[model samples]
Target: MKDVARVIVTYDCPRNCPNCCNEHIGDVPAVKFEDLLKYKELVITGGEPMEIAPRVVEMIHRLQANGYNGKLWLYTSCLKTTKWADRAVLQAVNGITYTLHHKPSQKDLSDVCKLNKYLLENLDNRAHDRSDRLLIDSRCYTEEVLRIIGLYDTGTKHWSSIKPLEWKDDECPIPDNEELIYYDLERV
Candidate 1:
């Protein structure tokens, strides 16, 4: 088994964003929970995992119960939903990388602030730098993104970044990098 695995919460998604990475995680057989135990890290991502928030919460519990000691991180846009701030979801993961969606509206920025506040209040462990993160989608890192990010900038932590968003391309990796970084993981 590889040292890392990106677990997709579901094959289906409501956003159905163009060139979404979920569409290109070519069949490698279903990655069972047990199969993931050997990994040093697990990144729970999705077609919006919050869509099945309960199942994700349970999955986190199950992984912990089975003695999976990896760092459990999650990736989500959290734009259309604030459920990511729910207590169970907040407490379970080691960290969360909230992607600030492209062309965000004022409501989107406000919602993110609310969610970050809830994360700080509910989990003391995450109150510091790096426990939670904010990333501006590279495609949308315009003046608007800067303005919105600055709205909530506490400046205590350098948490906001603008990385290339993940997308599917015939020869590109999930991070939308033109280079094929590593060979696809194949089970032993």
Candidate 2:
């Protein structure tokens, strides 16, 4: 059985990386926090959860206060960890997953590594091994649907009248409802 439930807390990310698959980043509903405790782990994600740092920390505290003992994993771009407030909020989580693709320079990579090392050294190690405390992924997910969410074919549309509007031939079709529920964010 899958014990982890990856929560899309918000779709408010500010980065414009080409491989983004989260189309709902600017206008998606936040997941109900209480609904997450039934799983063994809750992975909180957003356009950038740290974008609203305080709220995310409050939600984490709320989860703990409500007797949810499962791990709380956070997904981030590692852009705001340099800020003391954001760093504190991140350290509170049980584990962290960073999108390595977002690192634009050696400085960003160095910061990410330093932050991950600190997190691995400081957070409780009950549910995660030291090596598992931080995860870095080049592409957030390997699944085709998840790697290409906002893209669409504009066939027969206004400008496409000249030619069939097409997404990159390599692009994968978005999944239907049945396929979506089975997506494994932990693997991303």
Query: Scored by CA lDDT, what does every candidate get?
Result: 0.60, 0.50
TM-score of 2: 0.57
Q: Estimate candidate 1's alpha-carbon lDDT, on a 0 to 1 scale.
A: 0.60
Backbone clashes in model 1, listed as residue pairs? none
Which 10 successive residues of model 2 have the least lDDT summed?
154-163
The runs of at least 3 residues in candidate 2 whose Cα sits more than 4 Å from the true structure, single-residue gaps closed, are 24-31, 116-188
lDDT of 2 by residue, 1-188 (tens): 25666566555666665645564223333334455556777667655777677777777777789899877667676546567767766667655655555334555555654554444355434434422232334333223322232113211111101111222333534323211112222222
Q: Evaluated with TM-score, which candidate comes out highest?
A: 1
lDDT of 1 at 125: 41
Residue 21 alpha-carbon offset, candidate 2, angstroms: 1.3
How would you encode candidate 1's per-residue C-alpha lDDT over 1-188 as one tens digit per residue? 45567676665556556666655656635655567777787777766766667777777787789988878777777533355434577567777788776666687677666665555455434354336666766777666555555534543233434354543254325442111112112221
Query: Which regions of candidate 1 deviate over 4 angstroms?
Result: 79-85, 105-107, 119-130, 149-153, 156-188
Error of 2 at 40 (Å): 2.1
